[model samples]
Target chain A: MEPNSLVKLNEARRERQAAILLSEIGKGRDRVIREGDTVAGPLGEAVAKAFRSGKSGMFELDGQEFFLNVQVPAPRIVVIGAVHISQALAPMAKIAGYDIEIIDPRTAFATPERFEGVALRADWPEEAMGDGYLDAYSALVAVTHDPKIDDYPLIQALKSNCFYVGALGSRKTHAKRVERLKEAGISDERIARISAPIGLDIGAASPQEIAVAVLADIIQAFRKRELSAAEQAKGAA
Target chain B: MSEQKLTEHLAGNGPAKDELQVAQDWMREGRNLAIATVVETWGSAPRPVGSHLVVDEEGNFEGSVSGGCVEGAVISEAAEVIESGEPRMLEFGVADETAWRVGLSCGGKIRVYVERLG
Candidate 1:
């Protein structure tokens, strides 16, 4: 390939990747990297695989080798409370490669010493989520157990296409919470998006175990979304 | 460079700033380049599936597929790939005695595909 053409391709690929990363839609786009002298392979299959898996790797088609580089935005976990569970969940999410932020209006709970190395926002949920920070690539967990602190953010998260929306409470508390949400004009479908009595039913009793369940549930939700997107892409193809 | 500097470079502010960005920058600067990617792995590979190693015509490389074990060989093959405009699939593992000589003593197998990147 000529140097000029190569440069143009590289520039275009970079631009596309930058745009996707900035958008944080959690959908990965694929770029086909073929042998310099070979014709490109079936792009639809490549794109579908890349988007579905969100993994970059090489594949072969008709004896021609192609590398499908899939670019996905970093996944984010936005915890809506700086409680004990948030302290456990934030670092655990970080370890799982999620960009983490703790949002709570209570200054005492959102202190740096308590949640070290994690981003903390002492603003209300509406203000914090106003700038499109919570998108499809984000997972929001409400662990404050205070309706005043968790309700607005839960509503906001339900409205957005965030991959996961979870809140801590018992079945009775969640039932009451649902009624409150219904009174506040939230649709049943939207209210249903929340994983109330949050986290997997691993018989978790302590804050740490609950955090584990929560992160596992969030991962399950994220993977399910990816699988569905991939299936959709495949069906479209 | 020191280990500290290497760590800092890899940990630069965010997720290892897409290695493709480095390849693109080098390509725009009129440098011939080849990209090596981990396509498949068996057992306990050091890096995950999509790890990259970008090699320039002059043998300099950024990123890694096997940390340091198989990069030297990949870089050497990448120089040939850049010249020939052909791709190559490289395999390394403890299963092969020859691979053991080449330093893939980690008891895992990795398959890397190298292609010239425009």
Candidate 2:
């Protein structure tokens, strides 16, 4: 690995961009490839697969061996509510290797006692999530169910192209939310990406069960996220 | 875990330093450095592929290629690689002749690539 390549790879990781360090087995030459950069032929296919799977391994192409060291930023959750559902979801997200940050302006609900070991922000979402705080690798879950609290981040998540954007609400509430988002000038196509009635349709009743459903839904969305950034829709990974 | 340990974990003080970052910093400081990366692993290898163990000329290391197993040998080899500017591939497993000496206790196999960073 060249010192310059190492610097570039670390820069990409710190910036939360996906990259792979491709090193030839015996030649001892390596280069860094960003998520969208194009490489030709069989090696390109292996590179794309490595980016998608977030796995690093040795690949042998036509007897030439290369090692792909994949660096996919760890996916995290940005929940807009510190309510019961988020309280339930926090630990589960941590266990799944996804760190979570809870942002809610409601102090009583966002109390530290309710969110142990969780990154809690008792500020409005607009203030809490500054520019570039949300990205394609994060799953934005807005469960506040309050228009004032939930609307801004949902719009921002769509604009930021979050991989998964979900909201906790019933069909009736989602209908109203949809109208509000449309009025806010978000495209119908963009508004359509919000996974309202948030979570997998697992017949969840309790807050904990709802958390489980949401985690499952986000996991599926992440693993199946689009490979080409040019083709992904709003809120698609 | 103890209360202090749990609080430390919860408070999210990040680990000391990233292995790659350490390698870069050492390079900038004019220290001789070699990096050992787990290029491939099979069975229950402790660390996954792409994991790095950066070693300085003095055998000082900041990361693990086998979760503390087989690191001594890797660091020793790193000195020679730093001297020659040539890369070497090392294989460790329970089936190897060095099993009792430097093999992975986890009953797994791993191929490590060691090279100097310029």
Candidate 3:
């Protein structure tokens, strides 16, 4: 084991980046492979699969054994509302293994008493997550139902490539929002990724039931997320 | 976020200490340490392959490669690996009854690779 490999891997994880510590069994060789770093051949394919699944395991390449200690940053949720649905979604998302944070500029709604144990921010999404909270591993849901409050984060979530970007609104409301996003230079393909009228097609009537539908939708998006290799490494050329 | 923020246990999930961070901290402190990882497993191994257990010179350890079933032996071996700076592969299973008094209660076999950090 290389002494620096452990430190590097830890650093990558702390920065919310995915990494893999590929260690040769018994041979004492090791290296850290960050997301997007390319390796060639059959071993590369195995590494790619491991990165997608975030599963660490033993691998045999040309009869030589190696252990891939793959690490994918835990996925999370960023909510752009402190509404009734978010109040329910916050706790339920955490229970579902997705850390959640709610950002709402409306002080009256963002009160700690309302959010209880959630990671809440009373500031606007532009203020709370302006430094790039939206990422490929995060699910962004704008449930404020107000364009003034929800539009910025929704646009940012699309540009930042959040795995799940959902907006709360009816078909009529989404049609207007779509025009706005298109005018803002968002490509049609990326705009199509938003799950407006958010949540699964379950007959959820109350805020709590809607939270369940949204949580299930987020899980499905995360589990079935496409492992596109293009986003693995940024600026490594 | 820093490791501290990431590990704040903010969510309701179970605690998962970043064992590699602990290992790095020990290394930075100039403490002789060894890392033991479950490189391979068969049957009902408690911990999955690539699970790590980092041990310091004073016999202190963090993480687990097994369900507290074979850590004592792995840690003792790690102390020697730290001293000799040599990697070793140790196997434990029901079939290796002659080598270990302690075997996986779940009837699994695992191969652990212990190596010095340096």
Q: How do the candidates rank by DockQ, highest first?
A: 2, 3, 1
| Clashing residue pairs, backbone N/CA/C < 3 A, model 3 | A36-A232, A36-A233
The true-versus-predicted C-alpha distance at residue A204 of model 2, in Å, is 1.6
Span of ten consecutive residues with least summed lDDT in model 2 chain A: A228-237
Candidate 1, residues A1-237, lDDT tens digits: the string is 234433444564533321111110111122333211122346445555565456766656566455555555677888988899988888899888888999999998889999888899988887777745666677889988889988888877776767789989989999999998998888887789899789998999999999999999998987766433443243223
Candidate 1's docking class is acceptable
Candidate ordering by TM-score (highest first):
2, 3, 1
Give each candidate's interface RMSD in Å.
9.2, 0.9, 1.3
Which is superior by TM-score, 1 or 3? 3
Best first by lDDT, ranked: 2, 3, 1
Best by lDDT: 2
Alpha-carbon deviation at A230 in model 3, angstroms: 2.4
lDDT of each residue in A104-175, candidate 2, tens digit only: 999999999988778999999989988888876899999998999999999899887678999999999999
TM-score of chain B of each: 0.78, 0.77, 0.79
lDDT of 1 by residue, B1-118 (tens): 2344444543543235456678778876878988777877889776677788989999988887875667788999999989987777788773455445543445798988777864
Task: Give the fraction of native contacts in model 3.
Answer: 0.83
TM-scores, one per candidate: 0.72, 0.90, 0.83
Winner by TM-score between candidate 2 and candidate 1: 2
